[model samples]
Target: MLAGQRQSAILEMIAGSGSVRVATLVEEFGVSDMTVRRDLETLARRGLIAKVHGGATLVDGGSTEEPGFVTKSGRQAAEKEAIARHAATMVAPGSAIALSAGTTTWTLARHLVGVPGLTVVTNSIPVSDVFHQFGRPDQTVVVVGGVRTPSNALVGPVAVAALQTLNVDMLVLGVHGMSPRVGFTTPNLLEAETDLALVRAARRLVVVADHTKWGLIGISTIARLEDAGTLIVDSGLSREAREELSEHIDNLVVVEPSASGN
Candidate 1:
């Protein structure tokens, strides 16, 4: 195929899947790895995609455009599920937990349905609904009222004020992106502020993110990596990235999605 055609095909693939690895493209297109990079670079130059560490993701519209829940929930299905389940194990009964809005944390909310005598606070509409529908009679669900973001998170002064009044056992935060330099981040500034409030109200920060979240920087920083008491990720993380993140995080739990228990 012509160079233009190959690059166009690559763009379509990224548009369809949200991301594509160079190695996978190389194998799929029967081209060299360098050739795949060139194709990715071409699309990136056109602002059609964003080049990441080992792949390319759809350009996120400069931190102003937050993806909806449907888009994010589709990105890493198995990984998010596994990460959510693993994070749920850390919760003890009768604990007060704050859940931030995001697909991964929403997944974690589902797993918490069985935990008895829990107090759940969240800015996520879907997350609060999870507890409302399935929570045990002893559980208390605190819905933080505020303006909702594209990611379906209720953020702003209202949400921040609600969080300020109570301290929780743990805050399970799901972020838009994560990096060594900036820590956990979000594209929305108000959402970031609300997340900070959640962090402040918790004894420990438990972050749940997929491997793809690495290297994607957002507009606002939520917390430094070391601030998180526990970071849960899926097995898809590369060894180099894992070792790097481990340096900053106290307990880095990498869950294997393929495992029977996961």
Candidate 2:
């Protein structure tokens, strides 16, 4: 196919999903990876798409746009680790906690492995796997059931139902985005519902997000600004942002990336 035709097709794919992976395009067009990258470069130059870490997204990838887990996981690795490290200190050993699915919360799960005799409930397959791979015998992990999304979060009725019966000491939640108006939000409607159920199941809510998540909005709102008991973010957050978030959230913890010892 012609270069223009291939670029057009790529745009169509991105339009359908709000984002597209280069590997998927390479396979679809039977082209070299380098060739696909050049095409993406051209399209990005045209201001039709924004180049992301692993792929491209609509330049205006709005409130409903959500990238896949792998695509988002590597975007802010150090900052997420720092945020996760601070969040781990908030959970006591032998307490029950729910980890909502997202890259940041998954990072937090790994940090909690050494905390003994804890009960973990999670809708994230990766989060559960981290414990299964390294958790002590005293640690119990309960995997919630539901349809999984590109973010690797189990959502829908099954996941919501599972959260209803459980009461956790704290919920270390992850969100797609948050805004002064929209609060904490997720792109998938079902995930929003599942996260809400999680909010209700926990005695306290702690949100872990890097600076990049602020000022953004998603399709569904999981909670309001004051809902979180504590909010942990990386040092990349601006002073203005910290002051603003501090006013709404009770305890806003910001940690430098180097302190995480990653």
Candidate 3:
């Protein structure tokens, strides 16, 4: 396997079990110990994992540590862009789409610019701005009012209340992390609550997440894997991870980064 593919698989292994021993990885990949160590080193430098005496572990408190939108926007650019492009294709012309706040969904908003006569409801300031700048006059953008979370998502009684009254054809959700066990999760408790509200407002739920989000667990879960009808991920997602997720989520769509132009 390629180096990037191996690292992605290693990360998923750690995510599934919390920690992985070097000996186990060596046996699994049939690679030299030095190769595994180098892989661990690379993942550590990226702040994706922590090295231990014998192996590595997923970074501690990833579930609770919330970074700002700008910080996250830089973390998984290619993967997010690819996932967003595929998600945008799912939107029909004149459809009402609900976008929950996160960097990936914000990327999805950028791809929605050309769709005609669409109505977008969102709590993200940046997402609303995308529609404001590029959306056509016939398109409608509704920004929900509420308190902003660290990730720049608006959430509170107000956002939830607004969603309770509106129904959309689809909801595109971005999350901090996800797994078969936790379904879809976010570090912020209130954001999880508001996201669940957004999930209820749509008939079809499509989750957009990158491979890096695989093993990380957030404090609160928005829904079980079964709740979402489809999940959009990038080509970098590992085969093992994809197979595991396929058992829970119905539709798993993988897209290439280069496929996105607009």
Candidate 4:
């Protein structure tokens, strides 16, 4: 196969399966290891796929499936780290915060370790595990009980009921997509419902998303643009998209990867 044909096939494979190993690609395309690596390099440069230790995974934006933790962790490592660091600075010590589930929120959970007197309410198993490992005695971690989704997020009626009973200082949310019309959305209906409950329970709704999520659309709309108290994104976003988002949301905080200490 020609290089262009091989690359197109590789993208099709990732689109269908979410990831592809280097060896697998080589065997499938009947190409040398170097050729497969070069193809992956080109795709990664275009932000179509993320290069992993031994393979490549499709980037998170516009994914059809709710990606597994391993897949997500492999993609957008630098962006997530930058977002986490900036998000951590926004948390006041001793605040009761509600965090939604996603790779970005998981990164934020890592930075929350040293934050003293924090009460974190979440439905993500990974977020709960982060606190279980390093949370201080003064800090409290509450995991909402519910059915687990493919993304390892707890959702359904139980999670929504739990969130409705509590009030939080801030809600840290991640979106599958963001647009002026849709605001924030998720592919899963149950997850969207749980997110809505969290939005209602918090005094301030803060959305943390990377640039890739800007133009995509999900199946369920969680909140309108006017509902967010603040929207935080990376500097990779286009100026036009940023201006459009800022016009609808009250406070828009765009943090650069360097300034965020990623």
Q: What is the TM-score of each candidate against the true structure?
A: 0.90, 0.78, 0.81, 0.77
lDDT of each: 0.88, 0.86, 0.86, 0.84
lDDT by residue (tens digit), candidate 1, 1-262? 9999988888888887677777778888899989988888888888889887777888867655688888788877778889998898999999999999999999999999999999999999989889889888999999899998988899999999988998999999999889999999999999999999999999999999887788888899999999999999876676788899989988999987753434
Top-TM-score structure, candidate number: 1
The list of candidate 4 runs beyond 4 A from truth reads 1-64, 258-261
Model number with the top lDDT: 1
RMSD of each: 2.4, 8.8, 6.5, 7.7
What is candidate 1's CA lDDT for residue 192?
96
What are the per-residue Cα lDDT tens digits for candidate 3 across 24-74? 899999999999999999999999987755677668555678988887777
Candidate 1: deviation at residue 55, Å? 1.3
User: Which 10 residues in a row give candidate 1 its minimum summed lDDT?
Assistant: 253-262
| CA lDDT for candidate 2 | 0.86
How accurate locally is residue 230 in candidate 2, as Cα lDDT from 0 to 100?
91
Q: What tens-digit string does per-residue lDDT give for candidate 2 at 1-262?
A: 9999999999998766556667778889999989999999999899998765446766746878778888777767778888887888888999999999999988888899999989999999999999999888999999999999999999999999889999999999999877778899998899999999999999999988876677667899999979999988876666777888888999898888874349
